[model samples]
Target: MKVEIHNVFKNMRYKFFQTEDGIYYIVEIKPSFWKTLFPFLYWFFPFPVYKVEDEKTIEGIQTPESWSFDKSSAVLATGGVAVFIATIFRGKIEMFKTELPLYIKIIFLIVMIFCVFLIRLFVNKVKFHDLYKHVNLKQLERFEIKVKPQSFKHIGQMFASYIFFLFFSVMSYIMFFLDGNVFVLIGGAAMLIMFSLVVNITVKEGLTKIEFIK
Candidate 1:
C-alpha cells in the first residue's frame, strides 16, 4: 500500500483536507459551531466585513467615480430638476386644508436646497477628464457599477438627501390636501408602504445592473 501527499495550489477550485498518515482520506473540514454562526454574528455585530476584490478585478470595475462625464453630469442635472419640481409643488399650498407651519415649510425648503447644494459639491469633485483617462475605457465603453450589499446602507444614506426632498414633499402635499380625505391618506400611505417594500427587497438582494448611456 502506498500513501501520497499532494500540496495544495492557488489554482485549485476546491480545497480538500486529509486525515491519518497512512490513509489520505479526502475530507471536507466542516466549520466549527462558532464558524457556522459567523454569518449571523457578523451581520448582527458591529464588526465590519471588507470584501477585498483582487487587483485585477478591481481594475476592471468602473464605479460612478469612473463613469464618463456625460453620465456623471446627470446627477447634478437631476438635482436641479428636483429643485424646480419642489418649487412648482409648493406653489399650490393654498389648495391644502391646512398648510404646513411656516417654519416647517421653511425647513423643508432649506433641506431640499441643501440637497441640491451637496449634489453640486459632489459633481464639482468629479474630474470630467476621468472619462478619457482610464486605460480600460475601450472595454468600459459601457460597464455596470455595482453597489455591494454591505455598502447599500451607505448608498441609501447618499440617496436619502434626494429621497427626503422628494418623499417629504409628496407627504407635504398629502398633509395639505388629503387631510380631509381619509381614503386618500390611507391609499397614499399604502402606496408608500409598497414602494418601501420594493426598495428594501432590492437592497437585500443587492443591485447589479448593466450600464448604458443615452
Candidate 2:
C-alpha cells in the first residue's frame, strides 16, 4: 500500500492510499506539530484522525499490521470519566457541607469506576472501517498511516481535568476565607501533579502501543 498526504488542519489531514492487495486504506493524517510534540505532551492530545478517500486495489489477506489498538480512545474515555466524577463530587462536597455524606461519596466513586470501565471496554471494541482490506503479500509492501484529530474524548478528558483543577482552586479560596489553612494549597498542588502524571502516562503508553502495532 502507498500513502499520499492530503490537507491538514491544526496539523491534521487525510491520507489517500492504494493497497497492492486490493484493500483500500483510508487513514487520517497526523498534524506535523502534534506528532513532533507528542513525545513531550502525549497526555494532553487526543487520538489522531484519518479518513478513507479512495481504494486502488483489493487483495484478500487479513493483515494484523493494519489493525492497531486504539489506546488513545480508551485512555481518553476512561480519564474523562474519572476527572468528571471527581470534579462533580468535589464541587458538591465543597458547596454543601451537608451533602458530603460518606454514603454519597462511596456511591459516587463506585459510579465513576464503573463509567471508566465501560469507557475502556467501548474503546477496546472500536475499529476503523476497512482497516484490514489492504494487506499485501510482502509485509514491506503494506501501507501504514497516521492521523491526529481534535478528538471529543480527549477534549472531554482535558475539560474534566480542568474542572477538577478549578474545583481545587475554589476549595483553596474557600479555605483561605475560612482560616487560611495551608493544607488546601498543598492539596491543590498534589492534584495538579497527579493529573499531569496520569495524562502523561496514558498518552505515552497509548501512542507507543499504536506505533508498535504499525
Candidate 3:
C-alpha cells in the first residue's frame, strides 16, 4: 500500500493517506501516557474502550467508541485535578475524627507547589505551535487539517494549575483550623509525586515525537 503519514501533534490528529487503495484513514494515536495507562487500567478492570477517529466522530458516536478525553495532555490534566480534589476532601473528612498539625501541612503545601511548577514547565514544553513546522505530508496526498485548535485553548491549562493551588490553599486552611495529620500529608505528597511523573512522561513523549519529525 502506498502510504503517507502526517504528524499532526497540534491538532492531535494523525492523517494517513494510502494511494494504492485510493483511501485515506485518520488514525488517532493517544498521547504516550494515555496510551500506556489506559490499556493497563483496561487490562485490570476490563472496561469498555472508546476512541475518536476525528473531531466530528467524537461528538456523534454512541457506545464504547463515542466517549473520549481530548488528548494525552488533557487526560493528565484531569488526573491532576482529581488528585488535588480527592486529597483535600479525604483530608477534611479525616480531620473531623483526628486533629492534624501545622508543620506537616506546610511540608505538603511546599511539595504540591513544586509539583505544580513542574507540570507548568511540562505544559510549556508541549506547545502545539512547535509541531506545526515539523509535520510531513507527501506531495500527492489529499489531506485536510481536521482538528484545528484555537490559540486560547491553552487557557484550560489553568484548570490543572489552579487545582494544585487550591489543594495548597485547602491544606493551609486546615492547618490553621486543626493540626496537620500524617496521613493527609503523606497522601498529598504521593499525589504530587504522581502528578510530576505523569506530566514529565507526557511532555517527554511529545518532545520525542517532534524530534523524530525534525
Candidate 4:
C-alpha cells in the first residue's frame, strides 16, 4: 500500500510503500520549495531510512549507489563555494579578533563539515532520536510508537541555533540597508524563519502520543 506523510508544515511529502513481506520502503521524497531552491544547504544532509536489502528495495529511494554520487556532489559543491567566497573576501572578513587568510578559513570550513558528518553518523545509530525514522514495518506492525523528548542538551543546542539565526537575520538586514545585497537579505530571512518554524515544532511536539488502530 502507498501513503503520503508530511511534517507539521505539510510542505514536503514522504511517499512510501509496504510490501507483502511487511517491509516499508520509501518510493520518493518530494522536498519543499525552499529545499529545491537551496539544495546545497538542505539536500546534502543524511536522513534516516530503513536499510534496504536486495530483495525488498524500491527504485527512487536513496540507495547506497545513488547516495554516493549525491553526497560527493554536495560536498564538492559546498566546499568549492566556501573556498571561492573565502578567497574573494579574505581580508574583508575577520575571525578570532583578526582577519584570517583564505587557506585558513577554507581549512576551518572543511574541518567543521567533517565533524558534522561524524556527529550525524553517531546520531543515526540511535532509534528514537527522530520519530520519522521509526516509521518502519517493525514499529508499525507492533503498533507501538516510541516518542522521546529532546534531551536538555539538545534543546540547549537548538536554542543556541535560534539565537544565532536571530543574530544573522538582524545583521543581514542591517547590511542589506548599507549595501543592498539581495542574496544576503533573502538568505538571512530564510534561515531565521526556517529555524523559527523548527523551534516551534519542537515546542509543540511535547509528549505526543500515537496509536495505530486496525
TM per candidate comes to 0.25, 0.27, 0.27, 0.33
**Candidates 3 and 4, the one with greater TM-score:** 4
lDDT of each: 0.34, 0.39, 0.39, 0.41
Global CA lDDT of candidate 3, please? 0.39
- Candidate 3: count of backbone clashes, pairs at least 3 residues apart or interchain: 5
Model 4 C-alpha lDDT per residue in residues 72-120, reported as the tens digit of each score: 8888998999799879867754321334455654464455435544543
lDDT of 2 by residue, 34-150 (tens): 333232344333444333333332222222355555889989998999799787767455443333445554464455435544543343233222333342222323444322323
Sorted by lDDT, highest first, which candidate order results?
Answer: 4, 3, 2, 1
User: What digit string (tens of lDDT, one per residue) describes model 3 on residues 1-214?
Assistant: 1234433333422323223434433333333445332222211221111222334332222124444446888889989997998877764655544443656556656766676566645654553233323322232233322221112332244335536644754564455345445455455555544443332222211111110110
What global local distance difference test value does model 2 have? 0.39
Q: Which regions of candidate 2 are displaced past 4 Å? A: 1-150, 198-214
Q: What's the candidate order when arranged by decreasing TM-score?
A: 4, 2, 3, 1
- Scored by lDDT, the top model is 4
What ranges in model 1 sit over 4 Å off? 1-72, 89-91, 96-148, 152-194, 197-214
- The candidate maximizing TM-score is 4
Instruction: Write down the worst ten-residue block by lDDT for model 1.
Output: 7-16
Cα deviation of 157, candidate 4, in Å: 4.9
